[model samples]
Every structure is written in structure tokens, then in C-alpha cells.
Target chain A: MAEAFLRRHTPELFGLATLLVCVLGFEALIRGGVVNRYIIPPPSDILLAFERVIVEENILARCRDTAFEMLVAGGASVLVGVPIGVLLYRSALWRRAMEDWIGALAAAPIVLAFPLFLVLFGRSPKTIIVMGFVHGLAPIILKTVEGLASTRPVLINVGRSLKMTQSQMFWKILLPSAMPIIFTGIRLSWTFVLITIVGIEYLINLGGVGQLINELAERYDLPGTYAGICFVILVSVLFFLALERVESWLQPGR
Target chain B: MSISEKTSLAQEPALVVDDVVKRFGRGTEIVTAVDHVSFTVRQGEFVSVIGPSGCGKSTLFNIIGGLLSDYEGAVKIGEERISAPHPAVGMVFQEESTFPWRTVIDNVAFPLELQGVAKSERMDRAHHFIDMVGLASFEKAFPSQLSGGMKQRVSIARILVSQPKILLMDEPFAALDEQTRLLLGDKITQIQQELNQTTLLITHNLTEAVQLSDRIVVMTYRPGQVKRIVDINLPRPRTSDVVGSDAFGHYVAEIWNDLREEASRGMADSESAASRRATHG
Candidate 1:
């Protein structure tokens, strides 16, 4: 069975092998003392610290908080982004009016507005969430707009010939057709939202994965810092993998 | 025409076009894509529109299709003018209109679903047409899974389930290779003969026009107006072998001579615009 799976998925095996090599190489650099022990901890020490973090550090709660921010941000993006995309699809005039503005938003850095988010919301969960949402929303809106707008005129004509109501056309034709493109936005948003939440934690001194990593770093517990960093990487990869599975399941042809 | 004479064949039109004109752009530069062009597509007759590119043959089809409604003329089912699309006039675009999201069966079943037909009934209807298009086994296959010829077959199946009175095809075979185009053309002729379907096909392929059309309507380029309507005197039930005949060559030459200069100018304009775009970009 293992051999069969590998035979079917050769590229997957190669990618895993490469990732393992990088992890091993990073461990070797720390163990060999290529860098200061105070700065860079060995993987063995990191793993031991990781065991301790899992046992005592409320890993689930921090995860829940971060996940909460992501879910809210993702939901907000879908709600706002889909409608904006639909509106842009309604007319060439609307596309012309708002396309440049949307492009500008997609280009603008979220860090530039951190101070504003901080000032308005204060250093609370709301700040982190707002930050996550801010980072997350751009791609969703842009991709949704692109997806909905790019429907072939022929397909639309098919709908028209069917005597489909406007709402029916949107649900049955435009939305489904645009889904593959829209999923791209969601995928990018997930990563961006996670990064934004961590950034917010760092900037405002909130307690999450980002805050924990900062605290461990300040204490010079290189092993513990390594553990937190490793945890961050592990969680991020897991989140992305989960998102891919969901998107693939939802996309019929994929 | 009296109302009863017009309504002789139930709710469907015998050939309903009450002077339709489609315009593009605006102000002083407003280009009339389809000038007040009108023609009746008698039920069960194979009518073909031949012209150069951008001669608004496609634009005219779009208007009849109810895809473009901002036109100056009226299209009717019988006596009533149609301002929007209805399933009675199923269209197949020059490019494939098969839904990328759906399997062959589902794409074909789309019209039936819109009409609120039972799922089983629509599925049965879809399979019947799919079989007719020679894709019976690939009912569950997605549009992307099919080849160009197969994809167009699915597209044909999709329109067939609607049970449209008139089938409007806009260069459906233009994208295929010559071999596939000939094969599909034969297949189309056979299916239409079997179904007794009225079809209005638009194309630059004169051989196809001559082979399938009961009569061919040739039009002038830009501000597309009808140049002449020539009745195709060829025998019925045409096959690939029909193209090898003397009548076929004569028909092809006749159509080309009429359209040669226009076709050349259109090609030149296209090249220049493409070059300009490339340079500017």
C-alpha cells in the first residue's frame, strides 16, 4: 500500500524528502554550534521544550484564539468580497470605477495601517482580529471580482436563453464558475491573516503564538524559542494543508 | 400574415425577425454591428449565414438569441416579440459553451433543470442527447476531460435537451481541425435530419455552408447588410464525399469570389491591429 501510494504520488514524496532535508540541515547548524547557543538552540533541546509547551503552555487555547481570528477574518472577507465582486460584474462602468481602487488596496501594505488599527481598536483581541481581517480581505475581494467578472459571454447567454432569473444566474452560473478563482483569494487570505495576527501580537504585546515567541526570545531560552518557532511553522503548514483539502472538496472538477 | 397562419405550428415561430438592428459604441462613432437585418428561419429548414469576420453575423445571432437586447428590432416566437432569451431558441456559440464545472450529462441537463423538470427525467433526456452526439459512455466526464471535438459534441447535446424550435449555431466547428470539422459536420447533418430540427448556422467555411444549408444568406462586411441570398441547389443528406463533387466546388468558388476582397481586408486589419497592440504593450 505504501509503495502504491508512493508510485501514485512521486512528486509528493520528493517534496517531503526536500522538507525533511531542510529540517535536518537546520538542526545540524544549531547542534554544530555554527551560531551562538544562546541565539540558536539545537533541535533536541527544541523538541524537549516543545514537549513541555504541549503539556503546560495551553497550546490549544492559543491555537483557538488564532483560529478564531482567522475564521472571523475569512468570513468577513467572503461576505464583503463576494458582493463587491458581484457589483463589479454588473457593469463595465462599475469595473472601471473601482478596479484601480481595488488594485491600490491589494498593493497597500497592512503594516502601514497598524497604528490606525491600534488607535481605533486598542490592544485587544479585536485589534488582532481587525489586523487579521485587514490583511486577509484584499485578496478575497480582488479574486472574487476577477472570478465573477471573467465569466464567458457565451455561458451568460446560455443562462439568458434558459430564462434564468438574475439571482438564479448568479447562484447557478456566475458563482460556481468563479469559485476556482475565488478559492485562490481565500488561500492567500488564510496565510495573510495568520501573519497579521502574529504581527498584531508583536506590535501590541498580546498573548498568542507571536507573543509567546517574543517572550521566549527575550528570555534567551534559545531552546524554548526554537520550540515556539517550530510550533508556529507546524501550525501554519497544518492550516494551509487543511484549507487545500477543503477547497479541493468544494471544487468539483479539481 | 394572419394570426392563425402564423400560429399554425403551436407556440413556436415559423421564422420571426421584425427588423432587428444592433449598434456598438456610442456618439458619432457608433458602429452598427447588425444593421436592420431580417430573415425568417422556416421551421425544420437548414439556413446558413455566410460573411467575413465582424460582418455582424454573430451580432445578428446574438440579437435573435436574446443575448443582446438593446437592439432596434423585435424578435418574436409567433406574433409576440421576444425581448429576452427563451429555451425555444437554443444557441450553440462558435466557441464551446459547455460548463467547465459540470459533467457532460449535467451540462446537457441544464435547460431541463431550469424548466423545473424532474431530475430523473432530465437525466434521461440528457443521456438521450448524449448518445445522439456519440458520447453515451462519457456522460460523467467534465468538459475539460473531453477533446475539442468531444467538447463541441457535449455542447450540441446540451442544446438538444432544451427541445428548441430553432437551433442557432455560431460557427460551432470553426475551432476544430479540418478532419474533426468534417466529421462533426456530417454528424450534425445526421442528427438534425433525425430530430427534424430547424438550424441557423453562421460560418466562413463555404463548403460547410453549401453542404448543410437549404439556402445560404451572404452578407457584406461592417454594418453587416445582406449582400445576396443564394438557394443551395445541392441534394439532401450530405456527407464528407459531397465536398469532392463539381457542384460543391462551384458553390465554394461562388461564395468565395463574392467574399474574397472583404475577407482579405478583414485579415489585413486584424494583423495591423494585433501588431499595433503588441508594439504598444
Candidate 2:
């Protein structure tokens, strides 16, 4: 039993071990003057600076602001994107007309449009949120279309055989079947949203961990900058964990 | 006793597939899939449409089930002719149809839920069918946890719960191993006898047809037409045990004899098509 458990977790254990070795090796190299301390701080210094950055920079508030922006943007993207996707699925004309546009949107550097957003929404959290929303929307829409399209014809036939209404077919058959793929789109959207939000926060010198990283970097507080980046990582981890929970809740037994 | 009297032929016809002709493509590219096919499934009768691949059995099944509306045919369930999906006709697909997201009971109850049956009432009815399919203990189990055969049973129970007047099954056990297919065949026979379900099954499996059907409709190669209809003349409330009977052997051999030429023709057509593609490429 123990062996089986170990076998199951072998990759995770190995990953942790490799990470520990790299950290220790890097720490040793820096302390021994084999690497420059000014540019790249040792792992221990970065770890110790976490408390100082938290206390001095008010990192928690910045984390909260970033998280709030992310939540709004991510939520809005799903709310808007999913329906657009369903529309695309339901109407072939719309799909043909807009699918390539949506694909182009995904490929477009949406973060570069922050200036327009800033001008429209003002240089505030709204700009960051809007940028994140736009950045995230395309993937969710495309993935939703792809997911809905991938539903097995047999399943649709089953629904048709039952004489299910269009609404019933969408809710009971199509949505559930396409959910995993849609969740994948959500994950992709969240990643893009996080990246865009952080980039916008840093660019505009606004309120978020991104701004904290910027300030720490300007002060040449390398350890504190890394620590601030760690907090950003923390935000991402928390959101991903929450997303996983939601996905599992939505699709149990799968 | 005559075969008609024994097989309950006095009952009204539950389903009639009158001259179904389905074609694909258009103009120069047009290909006929099914042509001038007609059959009747009597109420409380289990009929199997046995045909080789490319013989358009699935096309016929789809037309009758209302999954394909563009076909040229009149598919009547009782008095009502249907060109689209009808509430009174339920179908079971050969592929895995159980929703992975739903529990066994929920999957079975889905049709009722669609019909706006109350939750408690649907759950009760779902449980009844779940028990009927012998998945009583696995009511809360998901489709992912069940074996292939078990999943098919769940799908069977699911379709049965809606209580459609006619059940159209498209090789519902074709994916299973030989043993599981026979076992499920017995289970389906039992279910049909219990519910007096008027069923029309589309399959290429001769043994499956002989085992589960009262009569078999054999179709010719593409532009598929009914070549022959063989009566089983076997007793009802039949089980897999009857598979060993001499009558069963005779029936299987007879169907195989009729099917051999059609099967070979289908194979030759496919091979020629493949070679044509090769040469064109």
C-alpha cells in the first residue's frame, strides 16, 4: 500500500527534491561569491525578505487589489464569452463570420491595447480590469466554440431522440459534455488575465503586487522584488486551486 | 401453434418504416445510402435489421429514429408519422451514451427531468428502472466507474424509463465482448418481454439478431434494400440458454447463408473504393 502511494506521488516528490537542490545550489553559489549577489539574491535572502516586504510595502493590500481585478475580469470574460460561444455554435452564419475574428483576437497582443483602455476607463483599476477582460475573452470564446463542436454526434442524437427542446439540449447535453473543454478555456483565460493585469499594473505604476515588484526593483532591493514576485505566484496558485475546486464541483464523477 | 399467434401478431403495429430512401451529396456527387426499404415492427415484437457494413442499416435506423430528417420516407409510430424526433420513439446507440457527469440514477432519470417530472418522482422512477436493469446497488455510481457492458445497461435503463412506444436500438451491444454481448442480449430479451417493448434493432451480428429478435430483416449491399425477412419461430421469454438449442443453430446458419453473399459484396465494394482512392491519389 505504501509502495503504491509512493509510486503515485513519485513525480511530485522528485519535482520537490529537484527544486530543493536547485535552491540550495544557487544559495551556495551566491554566498561563495561564484554569482553576483546584487543582481540575483540567494534563496535564503529572498525567503527572509518575505516578512520585510509584507510589513514595509503593504504587500497584502496590493495582492488583494490584483486578486479583485482578476476575479471581476475573469468572471466577466466567462459570462460574456460562453454565450458568444454558444451563439457561434447555434448559428453557423455567426460562427463563420466571427470565428476567424475571435481567432485573430486571441493572437493579437491585447495587452498593447491598455493605452486605449486607460484613456477610456481612466488610469485606475478599471483599466487593468478591462485590459484583463479583453485579453482573456477571446480564448474563452474560441474554446467554448471548440468544446461545443466536439460534442459527440451520438449524444446529440440521444437528446434529439428524446425530443428535448433546444434549451434542454443545451443545458442538459451540450453544456455538460463541453464543460471540461470550457474549463480548459477558463484556465487559459485566467492565465492570460493574470499576465495582462500584472503587466498593466506595472506599466501604469498602479496598486497591485506588480507595482510592488516595480518599486522594489527601482530601489535595487533584489530579494524584496523576488519576494513580491512570490506573492504574485501565491495569488496565481490560490486562483488555480479555486478554479480546480469549481471545475470538480461542476463535473463530478469525471 | 402458429408463429403469428405465438409472437403476439394480433397486436397493432407499433412502428412502420415505409419505403425509406436516403441519399447523400447532390447531383453528380450523389450517392444512394438506403433505397426503397420497408418494414413493420408489431407492438410487443422485437425485430432486428441485420445487414453488412455499407448496407445502410444505420441510415435506416437514423431515418426511423428521426435523427435524419432529410431522408425520403414515412416513419410512423402508431398513427403519427414522424419526420423529426418524436417523444414516443426512444433510441439506444451502439456507442457509449451514458453521460459521464451524471450518476446512474440521474442518467436514467434524464428523460423524465426533460419532461418536467418532479425530482422526487423522477428519482423514484429512475430507481425503478435502475433496479430493473440490475444496477440497483450502483444507482449513485457514475458512468466512468462502470464497465462497458454495465454502461450499456445504464443507457438501456435510461431509454426505457421514458416509456416510449417503440424502441430503436442501433447495435446497442456491438462494442461489447462476445460473452458480455450474449449476457446483455439475454438481459435485453428479459426487459423486452417484461415491458412488451416494440423494438427495432439494427445490427450486423447474426448471433445477436438470432438471440434477441423475433424476426430478422436482411438487407443487400449499398442502395440497401430488403433482401429477405427471416422469422425466428423460436419461443418467447427466450434467454441465452436457447442459443444452444438446435433451432437456434438452424436460424443462425440460415441467416449466415443469406448474409454471406451480401457481406462479401460489401467487402468488395469497400476494397474497390479504397483502390479507386489510391489510384486517384
lDDT of each: 0.81, 0.92
Q: What is the lDDT of candidate 2?
A: 0.92
Q: Fnat per model, in the order given?
A: 0.78, 0.93
Backbone clashes (count) for model 2:
0
Query: Which candidate leads the pack in TM-score?
Result: 2
Give the alpha carbon lDDT tens digit for every residue of A1-254 in model 2. 99999999999999999999999999999999999999789999999999998898899999999999999999999999999999998899999999999889988888888788888999899999989999899999999999999999889888988888888889999999999999999999999999999999988889799888999888989999999999999999999999999999999999
Writing each residue's lDDT as its tens digit, candidate 2 over B42-67 gives 88889999989999988887888888
**Model 1, docking class:** medium
Cα deviation in Å at residue B152, candidate 1?
1.7
Q: What are the per-residue Cα lDDT tens digits for candidate 1 across B1-281? A: 88897666533545677677888887998988877777777777788999999899888787778877788978877776766776678888887888888888998998888889999999999999999999999999888888999999988888888888889899999998988988898999999889879999989888889888888988888778777788888887778788899998998899888888778877887899999999999
Question: Which residue pairs in model 2 clash with each other?
Answer: none
Q: What is the DockQ of candidate 1?
A: 0.56
